[model samples]
Target: MNAIRQRIDTEVIPTPGPNPKNPLQARHLDHRLVHDLIARPEILGRLRALVGNDLVVWASYFFTKEPGGKEIPWHQDANYWPIEPPLNLSVWMAIDEVTTENSCVRIIPGSHRRVVPHVPARDGVAFGQEADPAYVDEDAAVDMVLRPGQFFLFNERLLHQSHRNTSSRRRMGLSARYIPPFVALLDQDAPPLFPDHACVVVSGDDTFGLNRTTNPPPRTA
Candidate 1:
C-alpha cells in the first residue's frame, strides 16, 4: 500500500492535469504492484464468483481527489467504455480512508436496470459527460464510505459520482474493471484505452482471443 501511495504521489498527483496518457489512468499497465492488486487471490475469487472464472482485466484507474478537487458528475461507466457486450464489474478499492467529507463515491440504488441518457457536462465538473439530470435521483444516492484496503463492486451501468472534496483530506481509490474474455474491447486509441493497451487474464483461460493479452508484470522487490 505504501508503494502504491508513493507512486501516485510521485507520478500521478504531480501531473499538471488530466491526460489520456497519465500514469494514474492505467498504472496497472506498467506497475507490478497495481497489477498484482487486481489479480490478488481473494479479489479474483470474488470476481470469479460474480462474473465467471475466465476474467480479463481490461482497465484500471486511480481516482484521486485532492482537497478542493472538482466533483465528478453522475454518469454510468458504460457511457464511456467500448466493449462488444458492455459487460463489466468494477472493483473499487480505497487506498485511503474514504468518507463523505472527502467525496466518497455515491451511487443510486438499482440504477443499473436501465441505461440513462447523457449530455455534455457543464463546466467545473471532473468528467466531460454526465447523465441527464432528469434521470438522476439525488435523494436516493448512497455514499460509499470505505476504509483503506476495503473495496466494493458495482456493475458498469450503475449511476455513480462523487462530490467535490470539501474536507482537507484527499481521497484516493483504485478501480479495476473486469470483463469476460468473450467481450471484445474495441478502439485502441480511444479516450479510455491507449494505443498499445493489453488486457491481463487474471483467472482461467482467455480462449476467445478477441483482444490483446499479456502476462502480469514480475513482482518488484
Candidate 2:
C-alpha cells in the first residue's frame, strides 16, 4: 500500500482519501485483477444469488482513510449513483486490518429497506454527499471490521458510514459496484469520472448492448 499510496498520491495535501482522485482511472492500479477476483465462482456465483446472472462492474474505487482522516458520514451508495431500481451491489475488499477505532465500515441494520433522504455534506468530506446523521440509529449500527483479504458485499442502498480513524494504522478498502445488465448509466450527460468509463463484464453476458467497457490493456513484458 505504501507503493500504491506513493504512486497515486500526486495531489497537494493528499490525505489518503481520493488522491489521484478516482481509482477507476489509475494506470498503475490493475482493474483486470479486480475483475478476475470477483468473477470467480466463489464470489461471482454468490453475487448472482443476490443480484442476477447478468452482471457488469460499472464502477470501482479504493477508499483509503488514514488515521485522523475525515469523517465518512452516514449515507447510501444509491444516493450518488444514477443507476435505476437500485439493484446494484457493492463488494468492499479490505486491504488492511480494520477495527472500530480504525473506523471500519458501519451500517444501520435494515436501512436498506428504504431510501433515506440525502443532502449536501459538510465541506472537506470526500465527494460531498451524506445522509442525515440523526436519521441513523447509532445504537443499531453494526461495525464491519475486517482484515486484509476479507470483504463484504451489500445492497447499494444500505445506509453505512465510517468514523474518523482514531488509531495509528491506516485503512483501505477496494469497492467494486456491480449491477445487472438492464441497469442504465444515467450519467452519460454528466461529466465522466474517468477519461473513459468502460463496462467490465464480470459475469454472464451483456445482452443489453448499452455498455462501452474498455478492457484493461494486455500484460506487458
Candidate 3:
C-alpha cells in the first residue's frame, strides 16, 4: 500500500485540471505496480467467485482527496461508462486511513437493483453529472470507513459518492474495474481511455475477443 501510494504521489499532483490530474485515471495501463496489484491471485480469486473466470481489467483510478477537495456527487459507474452489457465490478482499495472526516466513500444499500436518473451536479462537486436527489435515499447510505490495504467491491450501477475532505489528513483510494470479455468497449481512443488503450486479461481466457488486449507492463526500477 505504501508503494502504491508513493507511485500515485509521484504520478499525480492534487491539482484541478481537465482529467487525470488529481484522480490520476487509468494508471493500470502502464504502471507495473498498479497492474500487478490488480492482477493479484487473491483479488482475482474473489472476483472469479462473484462474476466468472474471464475478467478483463479495462480501467483504474486513484481517487486522491486532499484537504478541502470537492465532493464526488452520488452517481453510478455505468452513467459515464461506454461498454456493452454495462457489466463491471469495481474493487476500491484504500491507500490511506479512510474515515468520514476525510470523505470515505459512501453507498446506498441495494442501490444497484435499478438504474437511477441523473442531473447536472450542483456546485463544488467533482463529476459533471450526479444521481438525482429524488432517487437517492440518504437514510440508507452507509460509510465505508477503511484502513490501509482494505478494499470493497460493488456493482457497476451501485450508487456511490464521497463528501468533501473536511479533515486535514488526505484520503486516497484506488479503484480497478473488471469486466467479462463479452462486454465490448465502444471506444478505445476517447477521453478517460487514451488512444491505443489495451485492456489486460487478469483471469481466465479471453474467449470472446471483443476488446483490445495487452500483457502486463514490465516492472519499473
Local distance difference test values of all predictions, in order: 0.86, 0.70, 0.86
Query: Residue by residue across 51-111, what tens digits does model 1's lDDT show?
Result: 7899999888889889999999999999988898989999999998999999999999899
User: How well does candidate 1 match the true structure in TM-score terms?
Assistant: 0.92
**Candidate No. with top lDDT:** 1
Per-residue CA lDDT of model 2 for 131-201, tens digit only, reads 97767788998999887667888887799998888899888777777788888887643443443456677
- RMSD in angstroms, all models? 2.6, 4.4, 2.8
Which scores better on lDDT, 2 or 3?
Answer: 3
> Per-candidate TM vs. native?
0.92, 0.82, 0.92
Candidates 1 and 3 compared by lDDT, better number: 1
Angstrom error at residue 91, model 2: 0.2
Of candidate 1, the 10-residue stretch with the lowest lDDT total is 12-21
lDDT of 3 at 13: 36
Name the 10 consecutive residues with the lowest summed lDDT in model 2.
11-20
